[model samples]
Target: MTLSVTPPGTSSGPRSGHRLAVRPTRRVVAPEVRRRRRVQLTWALMVLNVMTFFPGAPHLLPIPGSVGKLIAQGALVGALVMALSVNRPLRVRPSVYVVILMTLAVEALLSSLHAEFLLGALFRACRLFGFALVLWLLTPWWTRRDLLLVRTHLLMLWGIVASVVVGLAVAPGLAMTEDRLGGTLWPIPPTQVGHYSAVAIGLTIVLWMSGLLRRSVALVSVLVCVPVLLLTHTRTALVAVLAGVTLAGISLFTARSRVRKAFAIGLVVFTLGDLTLGSVVTTWLARGQDTAELGALTGRKAVWEAILAQPRSAMEVLFGFGLSNKSFNGLPIDSNWLGTYYDVGLVGCALTVMLVLFVLVAAWFRPQGPHRALALFLVAYCVVASFTESGLSEASPYLLELTLAASLVYSTPTREGPR
Candidate 1:
């Protein structure tokens, strides 16, 4: 046999060709490695996500608000960096909601330029940007929808439990705000704790409906949250939870199937249990006081009046004050819509409304399922809650939940594994 000589760079024989082929294979990651890496990233994201809620935890570090903001921004940036470093094809499909968020962020940045406190404006803008960025980074994980949902719920449960422990340890007396037993971590307002616990309860319902979590576990979770919700004395949280559960219940009941019907029954039972628990808690807490006293809007009307009373030029009316303008009549604006209007003007307010509407419409369009139900409940809850709580404009746990709901609603159903 004549041994034919090959060029230096070219394969000469079968072994040489095999070597060349194996060289490229080195770059191909093993499935085990990929799976391990993905799990690590998912856990990292979960930790970061939970940490975003407790930035004010004194036991963790007695950092100031600005420093906490910086830490959150830094963690998000780091997450984005790690996500980018993953040898996976990133899918960024910006929906209408994403566009609105980006627009609001940019608008806020511009408004910040004219803000009284430039540094504060910058901080607020960074926080908003971080929210958008974190949402975007999270989109990739939606490919593993089941895993994502499970991990999210688990992380949320861990976070709430941790908050309870820390709150008890750090500020046991403060847990009972006035007369109600407000279970929240130190430095977090009871209202916020109620809001977030309600959200967690909502997610638990969604998970149960979707069969991601066991009905028993879900019921227990909801039951646990009821006291936390009631303890905050946050009527808004209760209303929001009721509205969300009602919407979700309608969706669950309307479906013509045995499983869905089972889910509806379970949800109904959970709701009844929650309401009974809430009523007992409320009655016990308000045993000596007039029930009408509990109905007070907590001076939210005064805050709105203060904001409306501010003299604004036409330009300011159209494109209102900056994010740095934190107070109305020396009190923080408690309403999300009012805060957005005060900070970024009418245009921003309009955009915010449109975003909510878009999410609602999107939820309506989603095929009748647990996802649709969850989306509708979340959007409705956020919308109703916004009237009482400053949610969307700020970097709080509520906003995090909103972002997750939005992503879930808008994300396409096709699964694309990392390349």
Candidate 2:
């Protein structure tokens, strides 16, 4: 709730031209407005916080990565102050996810006790804990139609998209490395650009089909995001988007829904893609890699084998080697399960498995609706991407997106609003 102080002239003005009124009247703000603002601020803070993950090298800000992270944290603090201005603290749902994430964060903190890079590991744990705390604070708005949070997230994504596009136009060579597009100005990886763009496209299309997003807005989002995604040449994101949308769109096949329009559009896209760029698409997917490299998952197999071959104590196996920039021997461990296992150990891996499984099971029983569609898309994309991308048990965008799906599944609204 918000406080609106009555004007001094009305509340503290002379009364009967004698005694002065001492107290100003307080007016309660609408619950919906308060909730909306709280959710938006909380979500926005989380979005800004994600920026800390990227290294600020050759960045637009021209500052050290640590300094950039501090600036991001400053924004986080500001958003926290605003989010806490409400009348009461929000409560989290009784989700297994709560237990899982708390345990993971605690494990991370404890791992820092024995880690080589003490500060790095501790800060990593803090980021996870902070996000979990924010999720708890956002419980009040976890509803089917919590469009306030969704709109804020979409706006943030659009800003990212626009920034990358600007970077492309301003510095094409820096943005495009070997024909793979990245956010040169912002310093995002090509895979990250593709992932975000794929998410925006999939969510926009699904939301539009569900009648929650305007046709024009959705069209623009897809038209803008799809090109960015394609330019990144991220096969994982491309396949994930197709899989997610196709699976989520199943509910719209009903007679009352706009299935025909969606199907027609899909058909057109597929036909055009096949006729116009089938060979080009194949070459892009190849990425100039040979059969051996392709089969080895771009040399990821060697890294995975090396990670597994490393000798570790039983304690290390249970808790892990602790977070070290999500890398090992100067190579990135891109697989989610392997990365989580290495950073947080077998226990973290078990928790990550439980988290994803719980959501998938819960979504399986959810009735047909926009909420289920989103849940399906988010989970499906993450599941597909996990084999290649890390962040299932860490403070990254994948985990954040999965947390959103968990909220949709666990939220218990007393009354159903219009779709």
Candidate 3:
């Protein structure tokens, strides 16, 4: 039938050889493998997103009787997602995750032995651990594009905050500051409000400097956020916001640009004016026996006084009595140094300090790219805010959200580190 002979290097039919010759074929990753990789990545991202939801904050989980139920539900959900991703090629490293676990350990040890709401604290700590895990999984190689994306994301965040601030300014009864500053979004405490606001403000400035927003819009939005600070009635928050703005100005400045210089000067003036006004109002509102006033200036002096009067032992110093009891009438221990010390004692406090140090170092050295200045400002604000607020604790969802946001923004890939 005179079949045509094929060329030597090409074959239209399969060949069998005693020599067991092998031929190269194009490598195609399995569709299932790709889908699984995508799922794993998505799960990791969801872990971070849920953590940012601030699941542990007071208002979000205010169930007094069924608190355990809520925690169990969260744990189960986390477990399910984790199990789904178990065989995926994703793993969390130690350095980025240890601090969170340590925090939980410290909380548990304190609660089991001394805290009033030990179970509550443990539940909250679990949420924080989840947050840390999400951060570790997502931040391995934040890039320049990532930094830009984070900056844009921060603008949206600030825009939301600014809108709330404007609402508070316009609404009378809606704006109230509690023992902590609580917001419409998070009715936990005033400190929580301030801490989150400060971080958002810092990020906004970064985005603005990166030209992520229209100058006119950014300018107007910033102005709107200012008056909202007044409504918060949080002297510390107002101060933190202004401080963040000023730092951003300094960072985004050049030797030129008269408007920029003017803005900087104006920010300084505004900050000082706010501080002066707050002090005046604080003084005017104080009655001679006003406990809040006494606590405001000196910061829980009464609480510390109560702690000092009570018994002291090496165990108490190292491992605190826990937050189960609010029995601070004996000594006036401040929440900053006192809370950890009172709950976990000296060793816990030391470890907490170490964790803070690590975060600070990571914040300082971590590449910030176009957002470096903003990241620094946010980190500084967080460090200062932590002193007055239970920032390290997962009890405040606002704080947790802001912390996660900050980590994401700072860790975003920039010419300056991993997302």
Global lDDT of each model?
0.67, 0.78, 0.50
Lowest summed lDDT over 10 consecutive residues: which window, candidate 2?
A: 410-419
What's the residue-level lDDT of 389 in candidate 2?
88
Measured against the true structure, the TM-scores of the candidates, in listed sequence, are 0.77, 0.86, 0.63
Candidate 3 lDDT (Cα, 0 to 1): 0.50
Q: Clash pairs of candidate 2?
A: none
Compare the candidates by TM-score and give the number of the best one: 2
Clashes of 1: 1
Sort by TM-score, best first: 2, 1, 3
| Reference-based lDDT, residue 105, model 3 | 62
How accurate locally is residue 342 in candidate 2, as Cα lDDT from 0 to 100? 87
Better of 1 and 2 by TM-score: 2
lDDT of 1: 0.67
State model 2's lDDT. 0.78
